[model samples]
Target: MTARPPTVRERRLAGELRRLRESTTALNLEEAAEGLGWSKTKLSRIENAIRKVTAAEVQQMLALYSVTGPRLDALVRFSRTTRQRGWWDVYENSLPTDYATYMGLEAESEWLNSYTMGLVHGLMQTEDYTHHVARSILMRFSPASEVERRVAARMARQRAWTERADPTRLWTILDETALQRVIGGPEVMRAQCRRIIELTEQPNVMFQIMPLAAGGHPGVVGSFAILGFPERFTPNVVYVENMTSALYVEDEREVHTYALAFEQMAAMALSPEESVAMLERLARQ
Candidate 1:
């Protein structure tokens, strides 16, 4: 069977497990599996995060590996929380794995830096625009009911930027073409642009427009987002989406590349005040 990449939970579990395994120099994979009375494949899967690692399983492995005290307690606690579900859990089977992962990460993000060349970023989209776009893209293959469900899911993602109790700072840079494009017709575009204007009023939100004259910039290649987490240990991620799949770059070097691109794009875009004025003018047009 083809091995797929580990999900967030899997990666966390695997990292901890691998650390534990390496700490005991005498404990090789075969020896560890034999001592735990488990198959080598099971041990490998658990270590690689190719399979679910339950609290009970973790307890057994920790006990066999001679783990004790606060460290064991912390690992067990982490194991328990891994089973917890996020808001997007309901759409697990509906959304692609990559998209689902993106939502999960976005939900935990403390800050987001996004650059879009031709479309409004997902977190900033209005319901009408979301519906129109989803319908146009999905109507060919998905039923109307399914398309509506997807739209609802998309709208739900907006909570990351809207919930003031724990607001996620969003810095979005859009190409002027995105504002001029009539997504759901003039009325919908008007409301959409107006919504963007209103969103700019929030302290946690920022907007910039790359004018038509800022022709051929680094972001002209595509769109992407750099998501930062509050936890110091959780490294920032750069997420890039294509027509069929998405890429998550966690390595510091690659993430830095995306960060530099966003900085350059933001530099060329209109100032916050200018962007709001641009939106207002587009809405009226």
Candidate 2:
């Protein structure tokens, strides 16, 4: 028997609702159930993501709980977004649950703020370059076929704003060392730079380079992506990607910290014009 796939969006909604419920003075599940006109079991299902939560219902509960103003609006919006389906859904089984959640956020984000130390950030990588990077991991996992499929899915997920009329605006600050570091060698590096140049030309895209000379920045720790959704429905999320897994943080304080860190990274990065010149410099080398 096949194990049931993780319901990423459903789980996210359920978790968010649960957190909201916890923060309120519900006093008892029975009281909360009567207030929302839901049975205890139904409430439990929504909280567990075993059942989908309706945005209207969520808003109603928030209103009843006195969760007002912008935060209430944000939670309402999040409930609606749980219905957002992305292309990455096909590979749900191939990637880990957290990775899948990250992909969905990346796809829907209107503005993406990313910082990569020296390695390739998934969104900025060329297809073959990604293969070279992912190939290294294939050796560790079972089922060679599953590995290939995931690589292809990863590559597919990376295709952002290639054709969108108003594609996501990507504001990226990559270490200058990243330009010098050849991942798959000269050819791959050249193509990657060319791709960067192409992506930067998009009206919504912004690519900046943080030179070695601009030392001691927030991103010195690792990579982080701050995703701003289009509809302004949810709180901004910070995605921290590691070798093994990724972390999505949405706590107000944590998000604020990452936002400030991204701003500092941007200040340390080269100006847009200078960044383009640096890309050209890399491509010519």
Candidate 3:
């Protein structure tokens, strides 16, 4: 069985535990491990979110760190939730580790800002478009079943925007080239355009088109997304993907840079109204 990747909540809990220990106690790693009566490696794994920390373990760590009051109560409560399984966990065997990690974060994000240069954003893709794109990108001679699994996983990821009561707010700036490219031929592309326009009608969805005429821009570097969580302790994450791997940017400075680039791209892109108009035209053509 594959080891589960750390969820956003778990990562946040781990960070808080480390912070409390460092700020409240004079003990170093070795001393803290001795105080807690555990090996240094155990404490180290907990702090790094490499191992799940039980509620009892959390309480022990908090006690050693001298944490008390409402903060203590909240951390204890949060720790219990760290081990809950996500819907995407079932597909872990098929999905890349980093992609699975991104899905976990996406599920918890309150909002997402994405810029796409090559294809439609996964959350906004049509099933047929996804089928074609998946087949094209998967390794040659890959079985049909593998391609179908990927399509299903991508579709499942869309439910966060469609079925959730408080759907995640999405602000995506799609490059005009994505629309111009004939992914699954004319009919499929038309349906894909219509799908984007339909999704934009939802109150929480925002779509803009970065026109080819806009020429070179900051997003010209590559495609990326920034995800913001509801909890203040959970910092924003910037996700960048290439052919084989993905990068998650959590540093405050680096996340800020991606945020700024997204803002600039949004500014240069067509307004929501205009983007919809363009989509309408393409859907008709």
Say which candidate scores most in TM-score.
Answer: 3
- In order, what lDDT does every prediction score? 0.81, 0.76, 0.88
Candidate 3, position 166, lDDT: 92
Q: In candidate 2, what are the lDDT values of residues 1-285, reduced to their tens digit?
A: 114543556556676667667766654666788888889988887777777667888887787677889878877777776655668788777777778778776777788888988666677788877776777666656676766776787778766455556677888888888777767789899888888888887788788889899968888888888988765435577888777777778787999999998887888789999998988887888
Off by over 4 Å in 1: 1-44, 54-80
Question: Which 10 residues in a row give candidate 2 its minimum summed lDDT?
Answer: 1-10
Candidate 2, superposed: residue stretches over 4 Å from native: 1-12, 22-45, 67-84, 139-144
Q: What TM-score number comes out for model 2?
A: 0.83
70-123: candidate 3 lDDT, tens digit per residue: 777878888888877788777767988788778888888899999999999999
Candidate 3, residue 33: the lDDT equals: 90
Ranking by TM-score: 3, 2, 1
By TM-score, is 1 or 3 better? Answer: 3
